[model samples]
Target chain A: MGILEVKDVSKRFGGLKALSDVNLSVEEGTVHAIIGPNGAGKSTLLNCFVGKLIPDTGSVMFEGHSLLGIKPHQINQLGVSRVFQTPEIFSELTVFENVMIACFAKRDGSFRLQPFKTVENETDIVEKAEQMLVDVSMIEKRDMHSASLSRGDKRRLEMAMCLAQDPKLLLLDEPTAGMARADTNNTIELLKDIQKQRGITMAIIEHDMHVVFSLADRITVLAQGTPIVEDVPEKIKGHPKVQEAYLGTAH
Target chain B: MKILGLNEKDSRFLLIVIFLTLATPVLLQPFPEGSGMAQFNAGYPDLMQRFAIFGIFAIGFNILFGLTGYLSFGHAAFLGIGSYAVVWMYKLLDYNVIWGLPLAVVVSGIVALGIGFISLRRSGIYFSILTLAFAQMMFVISYSDLFGRFVGTTITNGETGLQVYGNDPQVLLGATEPSSPHFFGIVMRENFWTPQFGDWQFTFNNGYYFCAVIAILAFYLSLRIFRSPFGLMLRAIKTNQNRLNYTGVHSRPYTLAAFVISGMYAGLAGGLLAAMDPLAGAERMQWTESGTVVLMTILGGAGTLMGPVLGAGFIKYFENIFSKINDNVLHQWFAWMPDGLEDAIVWVLHFFVGKGWHLTLGVLFMLVVIFLPGGLVEGGTRIWRFIRGTDRKEKTADATHQPEHVAYVAEKEEF
Candidate 1:
């Protein structure tokens, strides 16, 4: 059995079927990529994996446990983390503070009411967050407000936040969607370095073919809420359905 | 040499500020006693009391507004419930503040939990409207004749206010006469202080000081919370609720927790107010009173640590000072001008001062909202930035760095 498995998951919004009979399996410690067009239900499927939206049918299993009825925060406790398309760093918080929260969440499960306690006292979590920041090359700007970071730096910080959680599975939804070409390249390199060093499994949603070709060990092409093809990067690059659904527009 | 990786200068500055704040009543005690100074002194303690009480109110409101970005319009009901609970304690078991205060807090907290759990199900404008509706319902119930017209829903004994005589047998300390409940030659006079320096006399009442200490503690607690991991999660929920959920963090429980904590803070403030004055009236729970806390938070800079206190002090000061000024004072100030012009000045002042102080308040609020959306703290920061000449570069850098396009796309993607 794969480390994470989704079997025939389907979701509907009113009359519109957002996802239909989608099936995929991700092995442990592999960089998996989901590439698709705008309305292909990539986000909906990601939402299902994290328990944000329960699928109409089918089951998502992480490790040996079923992820059907678990709450969203409970899912995070089970070692699954997701990064949004827009770098959702707390704009009002300092970079160090932003990562520190993630570290605390990972250590103490959600709903801790230790109001008088200090976050600085958690030496282990602090050390882990500091190490993650260094890995992402964000140590220099750690004191700066998260709002003040460059687009590329924001993505890196978001990645660091996810890393601080020490998750087994990291999900990224269009991690480099609105970044400039240079920033996009920087993010690709950062993700590649992190994957190699940490050996954490990641399932990324991407529109940029270059990022997909460079880092993906395996690729799944989603079109109109269905996984049309799932294969290695070389085979995915030349697949007829993927080309027609996604690459044709690019050409 | 850097402790916890924080700058020494910043740490030192913080230490000094905390020290000064803790020692304010003792350190700032030697100003003079003329009419002007006496007026300032007379206002100081009451202003300080308001600063703490309303500061608590706003801080609680901030948990909902600052963390979750949900504007609650029924927070005053919690405050009212707290005050009423204290009053009931005083009526049933004499003025034993120890019991009254804790009872008030517990009662208010339970009420807040019930209200917050139900209200948090809705989001955005609907949530705000729902809270407003509940507050109005509470106000109506409090004024309804079901509780008797003379007693109202919660009569405050004709506004003579409840008095804690300190002579009841049930009180922890031994019973004493109502007029002089002395312990070691110092009478337990709630409002007794006379600081005379030349022509200026400044008085700081014990009751007011008691309230001040509570307020300071509340402020410090709020500061700690703002720096906590839970606070960060609340802000994350505010910034993007969807993202928090997608990250396997349920937004509901976090938001509900913030709402309840804030409600408890409001309750504490209300209990303190009753402790100082020993009165609980239905009017305190009015929707307008709830709106006032929102005004304080917004006016002071909603998310900043000290902003709400400053906002509360500002509004309370104006309420006291401006309302005291009548047409006579206005006429006296404009007497030197030409008759027609002086009359005109008096007329305009009449429209804003005295009973019309709310008009002045309204205008001030509008100006603050339009010119300084971040409120008084932002205005002060802007002034400081102008003096330092470092604002322009920072603004430009901040503008350039934010991922606006990504935010826009994400917003569109939500549908």
Candidate 2:
């Protein structure tokens, strides 16, 4: 069985159907890419996975448990982590402190109150955060405020923060949305290196074809509110439906 | 190197608070009694008691507002609840403050838990409005004879407030009860060390010391909270609640915990107020009183360790000292000037001194909020950094290395 199973999951906002009968299964050890145009319900599906929304029908199962009727933190506790489109980081904190907070969240559960113990005393979490920063090549900028980092570096730091949680499944929502060419290439390489080193399962939503082609082990092209094609990158590039989906909308 | 799990800097801050609380009587009495400046001296026992009491209140308020960025507009409800609890305890029990204080804290905590449970369901302005509504409801319930008509008993004693009475049943005390609240024969109002040096006489009152010790403990507790992981989570809630939830941390419980703890602190302050003065009034629970605590935190620098206490002392000093300055005093200060000039000076100062202290406070609050967004502590940091900048300029001889962002200014202010 796959690690994640979403069967007949549908969501409707008032009279608009955001998702309809979406069935997606992500195998335990694959980089699955969800690619679609702007209004194609990609974020809605991602939000459904992380308990930000409850589908009007059907179920989402991560590992062996149902992910419905639970809080967002409870979803995170189930080894699912998400990187936002806008890098929703603690802008007021240092990079190290930011990653360290995630590490603490991973080490301790959603509601542990260590009111007397300082974060400095959590040596294991600190070491893990430092290690994650090194993996992301962000150790040099660890002391800098998270807000001071460039857009690309902020995404990298955000990735490091997610990695610090030791998530089993990482969800990326347009990770390379607003990066320069150099930064986007660097991010692809970094994400590729991380996948190779850690064998982490990532489900990325991307509009960037280059990033999708570089990192995705499996590609699912979504159109309107349903998946039109699921294939390898080579097959996906030459698919007739993809051409119609892209070319039909171009003019 | 650490006290109560706080780091060296935090420990030092708490130590300074403890030292200052202990030395308040001496430090406030800087001027000799016969000097003109003695009129500005804030060493009187009642004023000192107010300083300690309000310091505790503001520190408690800071835990919710400063750390979590939750602006509660009804925190004074807890204070009022605490005072009422204490007064009820004294009326039923004895003149001993020990019986009333603990009950006050417990009742206030329970009331806070109830209010917080309901209010925390909503955030931002909604949360603030909920708390305000609860406080207003309490005020309205206690203000008139609603309770007297319904329950056949006056719970808050209506508008005159709840207080210890003469003819009440004294099960805890024998025939005679002290005129004021006491702790096992230690009178709250009793003072000593009236030795005169020149015209200066510094009276050390038991009431002030009692309140001071508790306030110092409250400060230490708040300092500990500021350094703890829980405190970090509270700050994270302020920064981004969504991010915290995504990080596998529940934001509501953490914020609720902060709210309840801060409420208890307000309760403790209220209990201390009643312990010293033995009165509970609904006016103390007004939303405006809650605004005063917010002003203290913001004016002193919210989220800083000592800001709330400093802000509380500043406001209390202004309320007591500046409000005491009349046109006559302003005339005395300008006596050396020509008669017309002296009159002019007094007239100009009249808009700020004495009864116009509130206007002065309003202007000062606006200036601090506008120019120094981080409040008085931020201004101090700015001055400190300016001094440091000049010192570094002499050595570095180059301006390129100094980044011109507000990032450095904020990060460097922690120490």
Candidate 1 segments whose C-alpha is farther than 4 A from its true place: A13-18, A241-251, B1-48, B145-191, B384-415
Off by over 4 Å in 2: A249-251, B174-179, B390-415
The residue-level lDDT of candidate 1 at A193 comes to 86
Q: What is the lDDT of residue B311 in candidate 2?
A: 90
Per-residue alpha-carbon lDDT of model 1 for B1-415, expressed as tens digits?
3333334543453455456554544444434544433333424555556665787788777766755677888999888878877776666655556667778778878877788778778777667888888877776666552344555433443233333444433434435633322223333335576666566555556656566667656665666676566766776776666656545566777778888888888888888788766767778888989989888877777666666766776788678777888888777778899999999989878989878888998899999877777678778867888999874556423311121111111121121
- The global Cα lDDT (0 to 1) of model 2 is 0.84
TM-score of chain B of each: 0.82, 0.91
- lDDT value, residue B386 of candidate 1: 93
> Against the true two-chain complex, what DockQ does each candidate achieve?
0.34, 0.51
Ten contiguous residues with the weakest lDDT in model 1 chain B: B403-412
| Candidate 1 global lDDT | 0.73
lDDT (Cα, tens digit) per residue for candidate 2, span B225-293? 876789878877776778889889988878888988998999998998899898998898888888899
Candidate 1: TM-score, chain B only: 0.82
Interface RMSD of each: 4.9, 6.9
TM-score computed on alpha carbons, candidate 2: 0.94
